[model samples]
Every structure is written in structure tokens, then in C-alpha cells.
Target chain A: MARSTLYQQVASELRRAIYSGDLGPGDQLPTEADLMTSYGVSRNTVRLALGELVNEGLISRTPRRGSIVRDRRPLLMYPQRELTPQPASVPREAFGFAVSQEGREPSQVIEVSIVEPPEDIAIRLELPDGGLAVVRRRLRFVDGQPYNTNDSFFPHALVRDSEIVRPGDILRGANRVLEELGHPQVRVVDDISARMPTPAESSRLELEPGTPVVEYVRVGYDSDDVPVRVAVSVLPADKHLIRYELERR
Target chain B: MARSTLYQQVASELRRAIYSGDLGPGDQLPTEADLMTSYGVSRNTVRLALGELVNEGLISRTPRRGSIVRDRRPLLMYPQRELTPQPASVPREAFGFAVSQEGREPSQVIEVSIVEPPEDIAIRLELPDGGLAVVRRRLRFVDGQPYNTNDSFFPHALVRDSEIVRPGDILRGANRVLEELGHPQVRVVDDISARMPTPAESSRLELEPGTPVVEYVRVGYDSDDVPVRVAVSVLPADKHLIRYELERR
Candidate 1:
């Protein structure tokens, strides 16, 4: 019992050092032998202390390179910016635009299909019973690394004739296509939560162990208050930061 | 390798059942012996499958209860509501009001202290070098269950003499005191991110294994654009959902 407590104490001290920037990103932790000697603990206790850090997503350990602190600089996301009108010269989607502004390349692979949506999504869209929907799923990447996913569903009857049903990227964005279809969304409600990734999500996003994902869902409504679209995004917690700036009316 | 794949396949089937509501919350899964017989797998594989479900926060296991699905209904939070003006008749803070509306009792224990603030918070408040601030920290509960934490910091020079520095709950909230001090916030910026909780946070919040937390930071600026307050909330992702309603002008 005392040894278990000692390991936790050692882990806490190391964590404080990392959070205080004394041990920065890409910085190497002390060798196992060194840590064992300094803490005056056995090799097993030192390994257990290091293992705790690994489970916190604070550092990664490898046989050849030892343990190194990870780069935790998250991508700042301005969700409100999506509603703002952008200059005509900028003809890119929000994710790509945000990435480019940071000098990082963004890319995605999209797959579109028509099917009966999930129960929760159908409820959000207020679709009639057995109503079908067009779903566009995207696996997005940052600088060629898979970063997140976006899956958007629209009432099939409302968007069957639009480019949303077609393939490839919507260079001008699907929102414009919705406007062209005369179903422009005038309002949206966003719900945000976080959870551990399933095995499939972990492999697909190439996430490190102990990393969690934020699930953001947005339901859009047209001027008539008819629900139009439901977009769900799964963001790796370590790589994304969401921001909102508000002013008193 | 085949056995490993078999366990994952079993875990996936159970997961689908849970997500599809075929196995609702508080429902019990088949006994390990039954599962082994049904899937034609060894007892080891059955345990592995159940372990996966536990790790996903979908179910819990014990010597007596076996395995039961977890209740995942999260409390909805409307963060934007805080900025809107409230009627004089309602003399409660946002969290308490929201909880009461949901028919749950809300309470908190607050501790007030004055000290040199953390670096990030000091920067958000735009405090000069070596400046101090007053922080009111609260550990809130709902229906007698520990919920989340809110820590609000104000520039010492701005509210050193105000009620914010006094220990105990603020009946009307610290924002009202700030207004009385002639530094009403005209604008605010909110930043949200998620991460695995540190050991200290995990114990204080009584979080389950594999649970993550959302770190929400808000900086309020007065008419002169000088930041006067910075409030940070640590929300357990499993029990809270944040919502934002937006309308295009």
C-alpha cells in the first residue's frame, strides 16, 4: 500500500513539471534507471509511475526513444464564424479555411448516400416516420494526418435534387447549395459532449491510447423553423479547441 | 489472433444492442456462462468482451451484479443564458436555476482566496506583472450528487473590497457585484476543450475510469475592453452536455 502511494506521488511530481513547462513538448523524461535511483524506489515502482503518465495521455513511451512529452497545441475553432458571411473571394469550407489560416493543409474524403437516418437524428430533423435522408460522411485530415470526422444528414425530400446528393467536395460548401435549393438555414442549435472513442474510432483516427473525443452535434432550421440539417463531428480532444465570442445586445 | 477477433466481434454486437436501445440503461446483460455458450466462445473471451464494454463507459461490472448498462442521460447546459438579463424575482445563479427547472436540488461549497493568479488566467485578465486576484472556487452538487466546479477570478484592484472576497456563497452571483463596482462586462469570450482528468481532479470529482473532462474558460471584458473577470469550469463530460443556440442575422 505504501509503495502504491509512492508511485502516485512520483507521478504527480512529474505531471506538475510537465504542466509547469519545465518539461515541454518533445522533451524526454529521465531514463528509467535514473528515475528509479532519484526516487529511491524499485524498478517496478518507477515503471508503474511512468505507466500512470501514459494513461493520462501526457507522454508516450517507446523502447528505443523512451518517454517524450506530446505536443498539445490544439487547433482553435471558431464555430460562430460559420454563420458569418465571408468575402466572395474565399471559396472554401470552414474547416479548410481555418486550417489554411494556421498555415496547415486540410483535406477530406467524402461519401454520400441516401438512407433512413438514425432515430435520434430523425427526431432532431423532425422527419416523418420512415422518412429517408441523404447522408454525407467525411473523414477529415490535417497535413495528411486523420484529425476528425463529419457526418451530415439532410431530409432527402428537401435536398435530393441538390449537389449534396452528388459526389466529391462541395468547393463552395453545402450551405450555399442549401440556399440555392431555397431551404437556407436561419438558425442552428449545437450540442457538445465528450466520451472515450470506440475501438473502431480509435483505429480510424489513429488516436493515442487514453485520448478522448468530443462529439458535437448541430441541428439547422430554415426560416420557417423547419429542421433542415444535422451535422455531427467527432473531434480528438487533444487536437481541437472550440471558442465563442459573445457581446451583450 | 482468431480469439482476439472473436472477442471484439462479441463486444461490437453488445455495443450495437446498447446503442440501438435493445439493451436499455439499467438493463442486465446475459451471464458470463450464458454468453460463452451463446457465442460458442471460451470464458476468457466472454470476459474480454465485457471488459471492452466497461472501458467504453457503457456498462459496469461487479461480483454480485455481474454487468449492467450505465445511465448516460446528461444534464443539458445552456451557457448563453448566463449573459441574458434575469428578472428581479429570480435571485438564483444560472446553475441553480437550471437544476431547479429540471426538478433537482442544487447546492455548492465555495472558498474565497486572494493570491497571485496562474499565468494563463493572469494573461486573460490582462493583469500587470506580479498582480494579484481574488478567486471564488465552488464545488457544486445536484440532487446530493457531486456535479462540477466553477472557479471565478476577479482583478484584486477591481473587487478587493466587494462581497466577492468574502467566504461563502454569493446569493446573487459575483457578476452582480462586478456590475455594482462599475465594471459591467460588455463582452466575453469562451474557450472549451476536453482532456483526461488529472489524478487530483479525478478523485475530487469522483469520476469513473475512462471519463474525460471539459475545461471551459470565459473571460469577460468591460466597455473599455479591459478583461475584469475570468471564470473556469471543469465539467465531467459524462454527466453534462453544453448547448448553444445561434441565429443568423
Candidate 2:
């Protein structure tokens, strides 16, 4: 038991190091010999400790890099319901659409355009292949630091005819544009996933190497159950956090 | 337009190569000279093309390795509601517990174990700060391949005094265990995020570079609205899909 306890201790220390940014993502960990010398443990013990961290989604070992610290960013999910307000009046101060209300107050800058979407996106909007759709791509920022990127698609017919569809402020957000089109979202379905950040995504979101990102593919449907819009957002896991609430009936 | 289009083509080809395992994760890409010779493109064009690949999360470049393909394994998510039997009546299977004649087949693994959870988990379960709890972990396999991992926690005192708290099979599942303990799950809340897989996650889920994953933190509440169990699951996004239904009054 005492021998195994040492392995746990090593794991805890390594975890703390990674969390504290002493070891950045893709930064090579000390070799086994170095770890043994530093921690005064057998190679087997070090391997066991490393294995536990692997299971918990921490450090990753490459053939050449030894072990690199995995990015431990918290996954962030912007729930669709948060974007879809009820029919009742909501205070303007309560609007968290374009910016984080408190704390760091992350704001966003976006470029919205009505373009001919690709086949996959066109299908989502129930538009013909090569048909035009309003595609809004936003480069989100948390305290002026780029945090995420969002791309949303809607049938052009719905939004292009609206006054808000102009490219000048295309990124006011998908929901706001939807409101102007009178297809207020009544329901939303969110499909989420995570992966390593793209180099561009890494830079845009200021992601570290070996860090994973979360993607939320949300489809908003109106009262008639017609899917109105589709939005895909990729977020770096280490920075943002996702929270949910469940109530008993 | 054609000049830029060619680079997009090159990027897409490399993406397919990575996904199809023609270029396995961690496998180095052709050197600039080699790529230039192979693709009949200038050095600048190849670099620009590679730049786009990095942006798309398809490859990673190291100081020495240049560029290596990413793991492209998708995360899988099994909905929490799917586990709840729509047919309330439990079927009497080989074990004392009930099984249903469902559309899908359930494996015959009598997997169950009870142990103390980690510190972070204890806080999530709200286990009275150092209080003991029954921590059960199992990997659900379908047709001999691992599908998902299940880990559940219960207050130690509640299950320790019961017959279901054995080291072997801990009352089928946490839900059944709770039902047997007379505190059925009355509510469930799930928070989800998606991102690219880390190297470790890729190996565990048989994913490759760019393969996405969905991380879910699910909390179950009992009839009294008290938190009962907290489960954290990572699903491969490619193989698993989530469908949710929400209705308005």
C-alpha cells in the first residue's frame, strides 16, 4: 500500500504541475530516468503514475516527444436555450448575447455574409445545392482575447429579405437576425464533441498544443418544428466551462 | 480564384489522407522538398497549403517533426434518457434483477464493483467532504469492443448496509441500485461539450487526429431533489449521435 501511495503522490504532483501551467501543452515531460531521479521512484512506479494520468485525460506520450502535457481546458457549451428567450419581455441588461455580462466581459466581433453554402450546410437549411444562405461567422473574444469561432447558416430567403441581414453588422448574432425574420426559436437541439484544436483554431482561440476543443452543433427550430438555423461553435476546453440545470417534475 | 482553389484542393486531399489512415496520427508528413516534388507546387504554395491543414485541425507541426497527422477518432455519446426503460416493468432475466426484451441486445457481463472515488469526484457527488461513497466503474462493450465507460458514486453508508454493495456486482447499475435503496432518480441534468481528442483519448477510443469527442457531465437527482450521482463520460463524436426532444406547453 505504501509503495502504491507513492504513485498516487506522483500523479497528484504532475496533475498540479500541468494545471498550474508549469508544464504547457506539447512541452516534453522529463524522461523516466529524470522522473525516477527526481521522485526517487522505480520506473514501474513512474509508469503506473503516468498510466493513471493517461486514463484521466492528462499527459500524453508520443513516440519521440516522451510525454507532453495535455491541455486541461474546461469545455464550454453555450446552450441554445440561453440564446432563445421566452416570449415574455426580457431586460436589455440581461442580454448576454454579444458579451459576457460580468467578470472579464468577453465581447465578440463577427462577419456575417449571405453566401452560397456548401452542400452539407445547404442541406441543413433545407436549401437547394448551391443555393444562397446567410452564413454568419463570429470570432468571439473573452476580454479581447479570441476565445472561440462560431459559424451559423440560415436559408437566405428568410434573412436576406430582412433589414438586419446587411453585411455591415451581419454578426449581431443568428438569434437576433432570426427575431427580425419573425421565426423566433421555440426549440433547440445541441450536439456536442471535442477534438484537438486546428492550428488556426489554436491561434484564434489561443489554444495550447495537445489541448482539445469542444464543438457544439446546435439546430434551432421554430414553433412549427421547422428547423430554422444551424450554428457550429468550437471552443477551447481549457478556458471555458459548461453548466446545466435539471429540475424534478 | 483558380490559384486559391488549387490550395484548397490540396488541403482537402491531405485531410482525406489523414482520415483514411493513409497518414496515421503522429506520422510525419512529406518534407517541403518532397511535397513540392510530389505535388508539383512551389515551396510557398506547399507551405500555404500546409498552413490551411493546420488550421483545419488535421495536422500538427513540431519544431523537429515538421508536420504530423492528427488522430481523427470521433466521440460517442449515449443519451441518459435512453437508459431509462420506457417500459417501467423490469424483466426477470437470469439474475434476480429484471431485463427487457428490447430492440438491442444486452451483453451478459455481470460487471459491478464498489470502491472509493477520487477527491474531485467526491466533491461533485457532494459526499459530505471526506465521507465515503460506493464508486463503481465499468466499460460497456458491444459485440466485444468497448462502447462507453460508466462510473457512478453513491453515499457509502446507504449502500454499505445493503446486499447490493458487494465488491462484485453493485446492484446492476447506479439507477437500479438507487431504486433498490428506495431513492429513485427523479431528475437528470446533462452538460455537454465537444472537441478534438488528445493523444491519450485517441488511443483509448481508437481515434485518430481530428477525430472529435463529446464530454458529458451528468448529475442525477433523487425524488427529494438532492444530488445523488455524478457521472463523467467521454463519447466519440463520429460514432455516436445524440437526439433530444423538447416540448412546449
Candidate 3:
């Protein structure tokens, strides 16, 4: 076999082990020297194989620790659930609800400010030229690990006196505040796309190389069909799965 | 300013031109010599700036045409439309309908076969351990350009005698054939994730380097809640956008 094929063979075996649960999350693989001795290949081949696994987001390599299998269990997000009426017992937002369902702690750091929104956000919100917006930016975490980011924008004129302009968590969620303002969202349109992370996103999310992110944008409209809010979520592809269940109506 | 900042400045200017429609699809960018002289930067810096645009899927580089802006307008996909009833004038599938709505030609090359599916697919289909499946694989195109790939799998026992087992296109779509077989899909669960494309997918889809793909899997169930079909679509992220509209019920 060609030398390239040899490295690929090693990678495939290790990938299989990870998928089969033989090598689990946080479980370290054999050291380079041990792998070389067992597979009868050079250290270069072992490194190449491990590199492949890292690029696939199946494993991570650190200077102190050898290659360790990563946690591949993704959080399932039900986008449709956002519009559903949540029980009063569940007071948190959709992200927190999903994480707590998985028995993980959820937290976030948020900053609220008013500024001229970006062109894309302006377009989605149907803002006129030079229209201002109040943006609530959040860096969310699950179990103390940064998971994703959500930045929601609302028309400044509409939410100037609302709780959304405050710099803190909305225990009842911003959607509820919108309802109290007499502009409850009756419908929403979600757009999903994916791409490689920008440098800023990579550092903020601590993503490994070759990791992509899903950019989900949802624009909520009130009863009068006026766009009220635009929420953009950047989810690490390896850590989240967006799901939608539809029934024929 | 640092050298890195200089290149980024150049990249930002070019990006603005593209987004602002000053540089359109198939429009050739300034040559390396011209860029170097205009920006008063080294040829190496010019290459780096152009490389960034290529990675962003905004431009393509070729030996003959140099660098040209790519067509970045994505096709809007409405997943909910599949479950909604279509008019008699629209005889094609959801994908074909969406493309034609944009005034673009839609076409596909299909291959049909029966085989043991991959483990993940089997689990989704709830197939017996040794059960077989009939797969209708399609390489779809828009305006004669390679766009995406969709592979729909049905339980072999259910579609063995159906048109899904034949080797040509289903003019009316495979979903209708399923309905005729007394297994109309009443509900569906869609799972959306993103990742770097495998070498095989890269070649088959003709994707650019640094481009990721949205892996969309939809499991359709009959009235009895038994999964009747599983469709997997590999969409190049730059070329497609999946949208969902939800109403509060």
C-alpha cells in the first residue's frame, strides 16, 4: 500500500474505536511511542493519524495530555419548541431548557447596548436608513464550557422602555417582554446556514481547527406582520444539532 | 499598522465591493500586479488577501481567468413546503420547485439500487439488522451547475416494486409513489448539522477548499409513526439556505 494509505488505515481504525465507544470522551489514546511499537509504523504515521482525528473533532491533542477522545454528544435543539407554550415550571429560555434537560448547568454573560445595527440585521428587521437598534449580545455556556453565542436585535423605538434594554438576564425571556409591550410575535421565520468560523468566533468559542459553525437567524413578526426582533445564534456544529418536527396540517 | 492589518484592510475593501454589487459574479478582480501597485503592498500581501477571499467562497482563482467573484446568492429552501399540498401546476419535487421559482433550470442525474445501508441509516429507518434498503441517489443541478446531492432511502420491502427501484428519474417525485403505496408521510423530523466535507463528498459535489457542508437528514413517518423514508442531503454551505416558518398554535 502507498504510504498515504497506511496513515489513512490507522486513522480509520482509531475513528472506528471512537464511534464504537471503545474510546470514550476524555479517554486518552495510546501514546505515540506505544502506537508506533504496536502498529509497526514510524512516529510520523501515528502523528498523522491522530491529526486526522483531531481535524474531525473526534479527539483533541494537548502538550500535557496525549490525544483524548472528545465529547461528541451534541445538544438537540427543537427550534419549533420556541413558539410552543412552555409550562410555567420551565422559566428559562430555550438554550437553558435544552441544556438542563441533559443535566448540564447553563449560564450566560450578556451585554445590552443601543447602536446602529449591521446592514444584514437592518435588512432583516426592515429598518429604514440610519435606524438604530438595541442589541442584546450573549456568550452562553453549558457546564462551564462556552457553547455558543446569541445576539438579538430589536428596533430601538419599540423597545426603548422595555426590559430588553437592560444589561441583565431576562428571567422570563425577552419574548415575554415583547408580549407585555403589546407586540407579541405571532410568527417567525428561521434561516439556517453554515460556514467556517471567523477568527473572533474561534477564540470566543474555543473551537478546534476544522470546526464549522451553524448560523441560525430567526425574525419574529407581530400580529400586524411587523418584524419585531431578529435573533442570530452561532452554534458550534460539533456541539449542537438543530431539529424541527413538522406534522401535516 | 502591522502587515497583517494591511492585508486585512485590502480584503475588507474587496469584500465590501462584492457585497455592495460593485464586483458582480464572474467579474474579474484586479490582477496581482495591479493590486500590488494600487495597494502599494508586496505581491505576497496581495496573494494573502486574495487567498482570504477564496477561502470565504467569495471568489475563485484559475490559471486562465485569474480571480473572479463567485455567485454567492444562495437558493432559499422552504422545508415546510414539502408537507404542504402543492398545486397541480407544480409537478416536480420540493427542490425542483424552489430552483424553478428563482428562474433557474433544475435537473438531476439519478441512480437506483438496493443494498444494505449504513448503520446510522438503518437505525433511522428502524430496519431489521439484516434488512435491505432501496436508495435513490441524485446529483442535482441548477442552471447546469453542480449544486448538491440528495440520497433518499426506503425500506426494500416497501419500495422493491415501486418506481423508486427503477434507474430513471421519477417525474412526479418519489414522495407521490410512497403515497400511492399506502404510506403517505404524515410527519417528519429534520436534523441539521454542519461539518467539513469528506474527501469523497468534496470530489462528488465539486466543493471548494475551506467550504463546509450542511448535512440535512429528514426522517419521514407514516400515520402509524413508523419511519417510511430517510432522505439525506449534502448541501454546500455557500450555495444553499434552509428556512422554516413557524406559527404559534
User: Which candidate ranks first by DockQ, i.e. highest?
Assistant: 3
Q: Which is the leading candidate under lDDT?
A: 3
Give me the runs in candidate 3 sitting further than 4 Å from their true place.
A1-70, B1-70
What is the lDDT for B55 in model 1? 47
Writing each residue's lDDT as its tens digit, candidate 1 over B100-149 gives: 76556789989999989976676567676689999999999986778999
Candidate 3 chain A minimal-lDDT segment of 10 residues = A1-10
Estimate the overall C-alpha local distance difference test score of candidate 2: 0.61
What ordering of candidates by DockQ runs from best to worst?
3, 1, 2
- lDDT per residue (tens digit) for residues A1-249 in model 1: 012368778987887677566898999999999999999998766766776666455688887999899776466788888887667799888889887765667999999999998766775676766899999999999878999999999999999888999989999888878888998878888888888999999999999999999999888888887879999999999988888888776
Order of quality (lDDT): 3, 1, 2
B8-97 in candidate 2: lDDT tens per residue? 677767766765557887899999889888888877666657765664456777768798886632222335344454344544321123
DockQ of each: 0.27, 0.16, 0.30
> What C-alpha lDDT, on a 0 to 100 scale, does residue B93 get in candidate 1?
79
Better of 1 and 2 by DockQ: 1
Give fnat, all candidates.
0.70, 0.36, 0.78
Candidate 1 regions exceeding 4 Å error are A1-70, B1-70
Per-residue error at A148 for model 1, in Å? 0.4
